[model samples]
Target: MAGPTTQEPVKTQQKCVAIFALLCCFAVLVVLIFSSVDIWGDNEDGITEENCSKNCRIVLVENIPDGLYLSMDGRRHLPLSVGFHELLDQAKHSVEVVSPVWDLNSWDVETMPSTAKQGQLLFQRLLSLKSHGVKLKIASSLNNSAELKTLAANSAEVHFVNMTALTKGGLHSSFWVVDRKHIYIGSADMDWRSLSKRKELGVMAYNCSCLALDLHRVFSFYWQLHERDYIPSIWSKRVTALYGKHAALELQLNATQATAYVSTSPDLFCPKDRTRDVDAIYQVIQSARTFIFISVTDYLPLVNRSFRGTTVTRYWSPIDEMIREAVVLKGVKVRLLISFWKKTHPLTFNFVTSLKSLCMQLHNCSLEVRFFSHREQKDDIQYGLNHNKYMVTDNTFYIGNHDWVGSEFAVNAGVGLVVRMTNSVKDKGMTILEHLKAVFERDWRSRYAKNL
Candidate 1:
């Protein structure tokens, strides 16, 4: 009897202990779940309507979880492909795109890797969005577009601005504006190479209406040149709307505030005396306090280079003069990352070598050049373009369409997005300069890069 009584009490105690433990675990789990969540949480993945209202200006790719993507260096990089479609998918009002070549065939020609498959799906979604009556306007040269025209007839419109007619050159700008508020300014074209195989870079301007609209002003200018009967009276209205003389605007990207100079070339639609894209590059390079990092699909300084297998001054450009001055006089460290894609000029190699030779002779300044070639696709049709046209100084960042080589670069109308960090602190404690330098250094050291 004594033993039975003792066992019953012991069982009760054990049950009570177990129940207490379960309760504590449940409470801890609840606390942990709530701890990770935020009622006013800011979305770092992409800008949503909710996030935009709260002034989420920039969406950093590499900072977020799983943002790392393996680039040419076999090192992980922040993916440019992550939020590209998320913005497009979230667009409710309009979609505007500007690229040198808006090749539509890329989506369906073949199955691509996951990133490019996403791009293909994005194109289809855009068409679907257009069919559903979302306003779609594309400012691209319709090269192979019996299909694009047909698709446009279903729900969208393609307005081609002939560069030869508009500026006696070509159009090489690649950007997108969604709903007149979010803008993507980068080096990727609307081609298959851009989406899948090419390593491209740009910033997504979210919840920044002023910058988007200013870039749209450039779009409006080119869109006016298309001569569409559907919108015949849009010229003067667009011109009046876009024309202005405001040099820079007070803009905020999340917490980083800066004065952004929205510069465009030719000064056709807006006020006269605007700094052309090339001129802006010159200014940035000249004003760099520490160093300058340049990444271009093609880099031809306006100097004497062997053009088409002949040594000539046809490439002599004032921009080249400025670059030389930066190295020869100011002692600025210059790192060049140029791409070797299909249709590249053979003279490009020799020209780069010449630059190296000149820099080798200099003791005051230093110049380094590297080439970026994809690891897998030299002999295959899967090769992509390294079409990145951008530069970053100590605190300033620029994304432009022009190649910066004066003669070969100025063949078309180009646009530049110039931004600087005015405040001492970076947005969310991550500097764009750091991000750029990390990426540049990785490419510079990657096995894909070649020294001149």
Candidate 2:
């Protein structure tokens, strides 16, 4: 019996192991194929499948779906550094940053490193990057970053765009594009407060060429008018060249899938049919399948109406209506985290009161609003404002400078980034909603938050 085909059993076992190894190799090969071809080219762009990866080779969102950690007690959480530095570090040819404010000296405040030393270190890094032959172009309201400019005097090209003159308000976007391939958009400003003190939320789009191209055109809205405040005569080309194609609203790589819309407001970039940040927020709110969670410093939606050419601002609360519909019509849970600080406009509180009263009429987790404030003890250094401006629906997340209003969208130059993490949103690891929920819960339960 022992001699009766014992060799056959061993040969079968060897075949099984060979099959498993081949499957593992096949799995890895598939992952590499998709990762390398994340960015798609227009078929007519003469990009054959063989050469597509060679030209526009890009990456996908790989970092843990967390954000730049904020530390009040100087105990930095996961992601100890502002991840933008990593983007800068990887830039090979160019780095373009459009920030409303830029101040290295702002890092000189107490707590972590000596403010001066931190500023110097950051400045040295900037100059070093520039010296390495990277074309560092910064469009900031750098009217005050004299120290930063001194270091990059010979290397970086610094331009100050007076946004108030270009648009109705000053430039409010704090975003950066590295090599015109990736983007980092968030509530954090370029100053140090946004780095470690402020409650900031931002998304890093890795190898998101379509979204990055849209934002690049948005940046061009300010970039072309360099050192000038007037719109150029042929400015339309700048937008048309980039946004002419029908871009995809959703993108995927491997098992990870994300839907994104790169939006800007005041509607200055494209034609009449283009998407605006205000409308994007309404879409996200109206499309919520279960819950809507929002954290913003302000929440007053005002529409400017013109009667016989005289413009008058009227209170328009579409977001409030969305909340009411989500609660009353769809039975969706709505929770809003609004920051109440000294600078909070008085009228915003009135609107909040109105919402609270409406919530009193509903129940079953219909609507809940919380106020978050920095606890001002005797001399605990003033923690930055809860300056985050973002909203998360059950299946989507929107982050931008727009404050859920028409006025900020109509007057201010701002941006909104939308990410749709559909059914697989509960995947736990890099699911955006999972990460956002954690941040919202932490803020909602903090000692500073009060349910009013």
Candidate 3:
């Protein structure tokens, strides 16, 4: 009072300064926590600059092209002038082929005659390698009756794993890695259909260190699993004797240079539960920012018990729950492009119906769900099936052969690669997004000509 109203102004100024300081401190803490935990991006373990090498190019191939030498099929081109024939001829000690099925009459294997032609060729080749003291191992789903029979008959060491056991709910992946150097992964099966009929795509990479190492690890794991209890026959033993234990172990250990993950489905050979992978996928979806894009052949809703001691239905299907969370809670944009199969299995059809119901429930959410049926590009009426299963979110891409449906957890075998793109590289995310959008529009127009 003695100092008049001047003292009151000073006190008010001090309080305002204190409040501002507190706000600044809180903001700093928030930023620190986010940076440490990588809230803005995936942690180093998920992806790193070293893993995304620019030198590694991504080659996209559509339908299978002709004039390439067939490895799995027994029919060889006697007039072989292609690079495939050269690779086959260059085999120093061993050649091993893994396919869904092998037919001897096929041109690919018939060209190279051996005691084992067709399905038997794989076993025969291994045996021949064993005779030369070259170690050979072959892994395949025991579910394939013809292939399994040949495996049982082979004099070479054979390991049989039940695919059903390994993948309680998924498919067994098919791939071949040669000498821990070259790798071939694609949709082509070893059967006649894949070789001559089905539209397929795959890549053969050479001199790619990381890719080759990853393939080697995959093959090694399966080989170890196969050799766990079963002992090779005298022929295989003879071959092993030639290589010596140390050399074989060294080769196998060297093959595990790169870390790789294996996936399989419910088959007689591999019978295990895969709920963890499913949970991991959900976590990825929930954490996504910017956008989420998915193309699948089927969509199924997930059902689980609720905490209330009764069954409660969630608006978003189990597979789409994380997607919904990202869009509705995290402000992410989600787009789903699904194929509507005209002649689908009854169970699958019912599952699709459930998905539609779920989509209707999330209509107000920032998610776009569309079903596509192929319409001919030129002749409108003639159509093909859309059977791609993939997802691209921001700079991360998931390309695989399996559908993103709940049933995938139980019935089908699928494999895919997840790639993280660099900021400097040209991003294909937007390109894929535009392609999906165009396809969806075309299908929508065809579905309801006037309404669209």
Best by lDDT: 1
Identify the leading candidate in terms of TM-score: 1
lDDT of each: 0.64, 0.63, 0.43
The sequence of per-residue lDDT tens digits that candidate 1 reaches over residues 199-233 is 66777867776666656656766776684323222
Sorting all predicted structures by lDDT, with the top scorer first, yields 1, 2, 3
Give the candidates in order of TM-score, highest first.
1, 2, 3
Q: Which digits, one per residue and each the tens of the lDDT, describe model 2 over residues 386-415?
A: 777888877778889766656777666787
Off by over 4 Å in 2: 1-80, 107-120, 141-148, 227-229, 232-238, 241-247, 269-273, 302-313, 363-365, 376-382, 425-430
Candidate 3 residue-wise lDDT, 292-376, digit = tens: 7666656655432334677554332556566656766676776666665454444545544433454455534455566655433
Off by over 4 Å in 1: 1-56, 60-78, 104-115, 228-246, 266-273, 302-313, 360-362, 375-385
Model 1 per-residue lDDT at 382? 33
Clashing pairs in 2: 108-115
TM-score of each: 0.75, 0.74, 0.51
* lDDT score, candidate 3: 0.43
Please tell me which model should have the higher TM-score, number 1 or number 3.
Answer: 1
Candidate 2, 428: how far from true, in Å? 5.9
Sliding window of 10 residues with minimal summed lDDT for model 3: 236-245
